[model samples]
Target: MTQPVHPPKPRPGDRVAVLSPSSGLPGLLPLPFELGLARLREDFGLVPVEYPTTRRMGSSPRERARDIHAAFADPGVTAVIASIGGDDQITVLPHLDRELIRANPKPFFGYSDNTALHCYLWNTGIVSYHGGSVMVELGRPGAMAPLTADSLRAALFTSGPYELRAADRFRVVDRDWADPATFEAEPETDPGDGWLWHGPERVVEGRSWGGNLSVLSWLLMADREISQDLSAYDGGVLLLETDEELPSAEEVFRILRAMGERGLLERFDALLMGRAKTWSFDRPGDHAERARYARDQREAVLRALAVYAPDVMAVFDVDLGHTDPQLIVPYGGLVRVDGPARRITVTY
Candidate 1:
C-alpha cells in the first residue's frame, strides 16, 4: 500500500486555483460563484485564480484535465478547489496525467462528484480534502457558516490534529440557487440531535477513505483507484455520505451489500456516515417526510453493518458531505474515532 503524504499547506496570502473539474456551475450561476470568490479574498485573505474552463459549461474532459495540470504545475498556485460538482466527473479521470499531479502536490479541496479526483489523488499517494465546494459553502447567503469557515481555515492553512464537532444546528433543505434572493438571507436550520454511535465502545485511529456513497459505487464499478487487494483498506476509516438526490433506503443497502459480498466491507475499523440529505428542490417535503427519510436511511446502514461489519464502530449523522455547514474530511489522512468519550478528531 502507498503511504499518503500531506501536501504543502496554502498560506493566507497565496493564490489558490479555482478549477472546474466537474460542472461549470459558475457559468450558469454567477451570483454564488462571485460571492464565493469574494469571500476567498476578503474573509480568508487569499487570492483565487480561475482557469479557462472554470466557467465553461460544455468544456471537454481533456480541457478540465489540462486545467488541473496547469494548476498543480504552476509555482505560484498554492492550492486547487473545484467550482462545483456534476454527474460525470468520472469522465475527467482517464484524461488526467498521474505523473504531473504526483510531482506537484498541492492541497486540493472538493467533494461530491469530485470524489473521482480525491480517489485518484489517494492512489497517487497524496492526501486531498473531501469537502468544501466554493459554490455551496463559501458562497452561502448572509455569511459563511461559522463552523464551515473555521474548519476550512484549519484545513487550508494548518497541519495538525483538528477535532471534529457535531453541529448544534444544520440545514439539509436548500433554497433555489437560480433566485437572486437566495444569496440575500440565510437558509432555515433545525436543531441537531448529535452523532449516534453504534457497536462496541472503543477507540479506532486510521487513515480516512471513501466519499459520496453513490459516487463511490460508480468508482467501484469502473474499477478505478480502488486496489484489487482485499487487505489494502484494512484498519482504515471509511467515510460515506449521500448527495441531494435522496436515493431510496433500499438503494443505499444494496450498494453496501455489494461491498460486503466482495470481502471489502469488513476491512474498516470505523465508519463515519454523513447526515442524509433529505430534501431537494424537486422533492421538497414537509417536516414529517424529512424525518422519516433520515430514520430509514439510518436503519438501512445498521442492517448492512450487522451482517458485514458488526464489530466496526460507526458514527452516524456527522456534519460532512452534502449537508449545510460541512466539515472537511481528509481523504487518506489520519482520523481518530473514540467511542467511549464520543469524540472524533481529524488530522489535516
Candidate 2:
C-alpha cells in the first residue's frame, strides 16, 4: 500500500470525541478526568462529547468498539481523543471496523495502550497521533505544560513542519490520582539533560513508526498490526518510550533484540527515544536513583543498536510518550531528524 493518508486537522470550536478506547480510568479517577474535560472547553475551545462506555470501568471490548465507531461516524466530530490509556486496548482491535474508521478518517490522539489503535490505523492507511491523552496531558496538575500545549495545538489545528524542542525540565515523578491534593499543584520534576545523539552526522526524514515500547512488543507477539512485508518500514523513524510500569533495562534490550531478529530494527534510518520515566508512585526513587535508572535504560538501547542497527542515527531524551510536557508524534506522518544540526521536526 502507499503511505498512510493524513486526516484533516480539527479546528477550534469543533466537537471532539472523548472516549475510552482503552481503560475507563475516567470513571475511577474523576478528578483528573473532569479537569481534563474542562480544559478542552476553556483552554482549547473544543466541545468534548463523551460516549456511553467512556466512564464505565470494565467495559467490554465490543462496547468500546461501538463508542469508537460512533465517534468516527459522527460528521460533527472533527477528532477523537482517548480519555486515558490502559492495558486491554488491544482486545478492542478485533472489534473495530476498519472500513468505517478509514471512511471517516479523523485525527485520533493518544499513546501507551492507545498505541494499539494507532498501529491499527496505520495498517488501514490512516495517519494517527501517538500522544496527548485528555486525562494525562490536558488534565496535568497545576496547569498543562506550555510545551505540551503548543505541540498539541499544532497537531490538532495546523498542517506543516513543527520543530520539536527538547524540554528544559521534565517530570517523571507523578502524584497520586487518588488524592485530592494531586490536582492542587504540578508534579515534581527534574532538570532535563538535553538530547544525546549517537551515530554518524547526517539528516534523515521518513514516516514515523513505533510507540510505547512494551505495547509495541505485545503487538509484535500477537502478530497484529505489524507488516509482514519488512520493506514497508524501510527508512522509517522509530519512536520509543517506556511507561509508568518502568520495564527493566533487560526487558527493553530483549524487546529490541526480538525486533532485530525479525528484521524490523534494521529498517529504520533513525530512532527517537522519549525521555525515560524513571519514577512512579509505586517505586518513587530519589534524584540519584532516577538518574541511574535513566542512564541504564539509555545504555540498554545503545547496546541493542550496536548489535542490530549500528549505522542508524539515534537521539535520546526527546519529550514524548509518558514523560511530562509530552509532545504529540504524528504516527505515519513525516518526521525529520537532523543529526548534524541536533534538531528534530515533524510534519503535522
lDDT of each model, Cα atoms only? 0.92, 0.93
Worst 10 residues of 2 by lDDT: 185-194
Alpha-carbon RMSD of each model? 0.8, 0.8
Displacement of residue 297 (Cα, Å) in model 2 is 0.8
lDDT of 1 at 256: 95
> How high is each candidate's TM-score?
0.99, 0.99
Model 2 lDDT vs. the true structure?
A: 0.93
Model 2 off-target regions past 4 Å? none
Worst 10 residues of 1 by lDDT: 224-233
Error of 2 at 279 (Å): 0.7
TM-score of 1: 0.99
- What does candidate 1 score in Cα RMSD to the true structure? 0.8
lDDT of 2 by residue, 154-256 (tens): 9999999999988888887677888999999888776787899999889999998899999999999999999999899999999999988989999999999
